[model samples]
Target: MTYELTRDRVEHYFDRTATKVWERLTSDAPVSRIRETVRKGRAQMRDKLLSALPADLNGVRVLDAGCGAGQMTHELAMRGADVVAVDISPSLVKIAADRLPNTLKPRVTFASGDMLSADHGAFDHVIAMDSLIYYTEDDIRRALDNLGARTSGSVAFTVAPRTPLLMGMWYAGKAFPKSDRSPTMIPHGPSRLRKTVSDIGQLNDLGRVNSGFYISQALEFRP
Candidate 1:
């Protein structure tokens, strides 16, 4: 199920798909309204990070790793924290800047680059919402280690339940079917997800919800 990893092909597929998702999730319309659709979802995302957040993060630097469109990144800043928003795609970074409120823009530092490579070590918190799904188990292990290195207190990330069928679709979606290149890969079930998370390190499973079969949201953190 390997598809050509051409830059144009990869970027084109993600740019369109991400835009569609962004519209659906952020729209003010009735049916597509994310806030209405997922009651308490925002609190849930906030809670995951809050559970392990140190008591002294008011002025701490935060890294919004893989901050697509800056939705969650904005939320981080709204909480009175300094945020360094980052994404692999230039287009997403641009959109994030545009989406930000003019007043809050000063608090956000948007950078376009790989989260694993970015010098985010100065930050106190590192958040990977709906990210960290792209790598294989080995890759995920390495990424977690890297993220932990840069994090001052804890590292928070979300992973999807991965299965054989889902894994195939994930790869195809990346190369052929052209799905969003996020929530890249994860365990297909809750048990496997828990095991994977725990095996890497002591992680508190924040809980799980139906966030689309291809990308279920289950927050895990090492504190």
Candidate 2:
């Protein structure tokens, strides 16, 4: 078991949570709130990614794995990258499709499915933000391996740092706000993640997600 529950049940809980998140994401008030919150951090996130991103995103095909609400996916597409945003939550995918700009819709697609199970082909880039917190360490390692195999350029993601006390606080906060209902998963520190990436020998921790809440950024490649 990853946390205190099985993977199947965790998936189910997230599927349900996705429904509520989708409702908020689609509503005008919530969307406006998102636009405001994202505006504060989006630029930094984009800049960090671009620092390691391949120079040519134009006409490049990209995959946004675990693309909650499709915020980053839309940004990539808007920058001229053909994007496919994937999530295990169908309702979340629906909101992503709806919130996407009509002009960019042709270049951006939303899919409700597991990234590992999907038929996503080789891509120039793959991004996962605040989305890796749901998996066990073994699964995260395996997923990184698989993502590297599927992407030619880079596989990037943000994960919460592993500190027992910090994790406890973060977990408690998420629960207090009645935020996450999924099973608790172990958080990883930057050192642990760096070691994992080094062990794979295909990925490199080029940068980090500096939003200041125990998050790190990692990049991977296949030799």
Candidate 3:
């Protein structure tokens, strides 16, 4: 099973609750100190993943899975990769398209739907950012397997790393009444993820990025 229920929740949360907040956060707009830290952390993580790819991507096909607002998609296209940027939220996808530079339009395809859709065609590389942080291990493993089968090169992604501060937040967030809660982030350790998706590829840790409330660990999986 593809775990449709979890994905539905993810899709709904991003489309409804997070669309506007994320648009502002990903842009140059000023946000709260905590969110500002998150912005910085995300920028660092984005650069880290990009560094793993070949410097020149002429003729490369890249999938910007869960490409919120298209920042990663923009960068990949600028590197000469034909990028398929897919996100679950149509609203965010539109924002991504709107923000995309006209010169880069020919290099990108912005779509809103399942990022792992086989219909997107095979890819040279895949960048998933923080998109996989909400799913279970089973869901993540299945996603990596699906991507591994379709991708010829490395898959770079992020997870909410298991740490003391985040673990506390995880527990505290759960205390809220069900209706008030957004999609909860599932924290995974780098070591655990290595074992969880071991069958798909050779996984390498790219260290952790922690800026205040934003704590994510980047990993590169080469199939």
lDDT of 1 by residue, 130-154 (tens): 6565545555666776776677666
Q: Over all chains combined, what TM-score does candidate 3 have?
A: 0.96
lDDT order of candidates, top first: 3, 2, 1
Return whichever of 1 and 3 wins on lDDT. Answer: 3
Candidate whose TM-score is highest: 3
Tens digits of per-residue lDDT, candidate 3, 69-104, equal 899999999999999999999999999999999999
lDDT of 2 by residue, 1-223 (tens): 5532444555576677546754553344445544445444444665666556665578898888877667777778777888988987776777778888899899987888777653877787888765666677677787777777777777777665565665786578666533345455456665666676676646555565544333444444442
The TM-score of candidate 1 is 0.72
Could you tally the backbone clashes for each prediction? Answer: 8, 2, 0
Per-candidate TM-scores read 0.72, 0.75, 0.96
Better-scoring candidate (lDDT), 2 or 3: 3
What local distance difference test score does each model get? Answer: 0.63, 0.66, 0.90
Clashing pairs in 3: none
- The C-alpha RMSD of each candidate to the native structure, in angstroms, is 4.7, 4.3, 1.3
